[model samples]
Target: KDTHDSLRDENVSIKKSYQDLSMTKASNSNVSSRAVVPEKPKVLAPGLYAMTPKYVPP
Candidate 1:
């Protein structure tokens, strides 16, 4: 009985972990779409332009 209960508890925890991971992935996907993915700047003239990451923390 003890073993069965432990197994059930472990399964529940595993299921919750998976749910959290899925939620994180979904949120990241949404955030990624909302992010302004920067494109390579075309240098029309010789000038140094500061570059930044494509994704910025909201």
Candidate 2:
């Protein structure tokens, strides 16, 4: 039957993929995945300003 043939083909491909997954999974299971650690922002000091004379006569 056409339906049976397609089903068998799908099963064959599925089995192949399952085997690949199993092979790769063995190495991955030993070590965990790494993620970037969040860093805290540094605080900055404010700049100081000098006062100037408003009036000057020569």
Candidate 3:
């Protein structure tokens, strides 16, 4: 359950980031703005996450 919750949060974060990227891409004017794209979150080792919270429910 904890893993599932963590994954869900990560997925939501990625989705929101993608949405933001799309909005920025649409409104950006300069052709060189492609370099401004946000970097993706890095994946850590198994049972650990780079972005996910560490709280677990009993």
Candidate 4:
């Protein structure tokens, strides 16, 4: 009975720690999207349209 109780307690603690780890990962991703992600600008592929008249094929 004592072993079973101890095992259950350990299991609960491990589960709580795992939950915390996953939460931390989610928080990290949120922070990255909010801050670090914008630092690296997205390079949009060139389209057929141009912004100005001078944008012509060489």
Candidate 5:
């Protein structure tokens, strides 16, 4: 019974730790996604400008 109780406690703690880690990962991904958004416009700008010249010449 004692061993079973200990195992249960350990399982709960492990689950809590995993939950915390998942939350941290989720928040980090959110931050990274926000950071990535600004870069997309910069990437698109160059492509648009490159195409503009080609279209203008034709």
Candidate 6:
């Protein structure tokens, strides 16, 4: 009976760690994806608009 109780405690601890790890990974991915998305529009908009003024006379 004692061994069974110990095994149950270990199982609960492992599950808790796994949940925490998954949450961390999910949050990190969200942050990275958000960071990459804003940069793309900033770069494209400036490059395209800056050339428009020069090309307008031709």
- Which candidate leads in TM-score? 5
Best by lDDT: 1
Write candidate 4's Cα lDDT for 1-58 as tens digits: 9999999999999999999999988766654342222333454665323234323222
lDDT of 5 by residue, 1-58 (tens): 9999999999999999999999988766654342223322434554452232113221
Model 3: residue 22 alpha-carbon error in angstroms: 0.4
1-58: candidate 1 lDDT, tens digit per residue:
9999999999999999999999998777765554453467645567743444664445
Per-candidate TM-scores read 0.51, 0.49, 0.48, 0.51, 0.54, 0.52
Instruction: Kindly report which residue stretches of model 2 are placed more than 4 angstroms away from their true locations once superposed.
Output: 32-58
Residue 50 local lDDT, model 1: 40
Query: What's the CA RMSD of model 5 in angstroms?
Result: 12.2
- Give the TM-score (vs. native) of candidate 4: 0.51
lDDT of 3 by residue, 1-58 (tens): 9999999999999999999999887665454433231255444765544542432222
Worst 10 residues of 2 by lDDT: 49-58
Model 3, total clashes: 0
lDDT of 2 at 41: 25
Instruction: Give per-model CA RMSD.
Output: 7.0, 22.5, 18.2, 12.9, 12.2, 13.5
lDDT (10s digit) by residue, model 6, range 1-58: 9999999999999999999999998776654342223332434554453233223231
TM-score, structure 3 vs. true = 0.48
Instruction: Write down the lDDT of every candidate, Cα atoms only.
Output: 0.71, 0.59, 0.62, 0.61, 0.59, 0.60
**What's the residue-level lDDT of 41 in candidate 1?**
65
Candidate 1 least-lDDT 10 residues: 48-57
| Cα-lDDT of candidate 3 | 0.62
